[model samples]
Target: MEASEPLSGTCHCGSVAFEVSRPAFMVACNCSICRRYAALWVHAPPASARIVEGEGQTDTYIWGDEQIEFHSCKSCRAVTHWTGVDGARWAVNMRMVDPADLEGLPVRHFDGADSWEFLD
Candidate 1:
């Protein structure tokens, strides 16, 4: 992909799709839910991310403090992203993005399971 092109992603079955400008880095969290989902998150300003397909077609899962809502593909059950309850923030699952686009991408480990800090 060209540097000017946005990073695009889709669920396993292509039911949900979105695109966003390449993020500075991605996050790998160790929180309970994140550990199970195994998603690599690319945080972005809410308005910068575009859900080009399957808007309102996802199944939402909210747990714990419920500060965020996880959106997944209703058909393929692929976790796509999470959004802040107040809509101020959002993140896309880079796991759903094309692997080629993720080459050399920096992944920061987050200690969401405990200290809630970046581990490195």
Candidate 2:
């Protein structure tokens, strides 16, 4: 996908929908929750993302420090996106986006399970 274009995404059941500018790359985090969900995180400013639908049909999961809230579709139980409680950052689950939309984006590994650093 082109960086200047927007990538649209939705939950498995189409309950949660959103759009984000195509990112140059995405992060593969090894944190517990992320590891389980296998989410490819595309981080961006909160304002850069928009929840186009299903606002009330989603549920949030906040763990540990509660710094970020993970949102999932209540009907499909698919983790769609997450956002910082302070409204600073937003992370979309690239797994929820169409494969064609992520054509050439590289996946960077992050050691969230250990030092919370990029592993390469």
TM-score of 2: 0.92
Most TM-score-accurate candidate = 1
lDDT digits (tens) for residues 8-97 of candidate 1: 999999989999888778899999999999999988773267889998989999999999999999999999999899888899999999
Q: Which segments of model 2 are wrong by more than 4 Å?
A: 1-3
- Candidate 2: minimum summed lDDT over ten consecutive residues — where? 42-51
Q: How do the residues 1-120 of candidate 2 rate in per-residue lDDT, one tens digit apiece?
A: 456878898998998998888776899999998999999988886326688988878789999899999999999999989889998888888898899878888999999999989998
Position 83, candidate 2: lDDT = 82
Score residue 118 of candidate 2 by CA lDDT.
96
Cα RMSD (Å) per model?
A: 1.4, 1.7
lDDT of candidate model 2 versus the reference: 0.87
Clashing pairs in 2: none
Off by over 4 Å in 1: none
RMSD of 1: 1.4
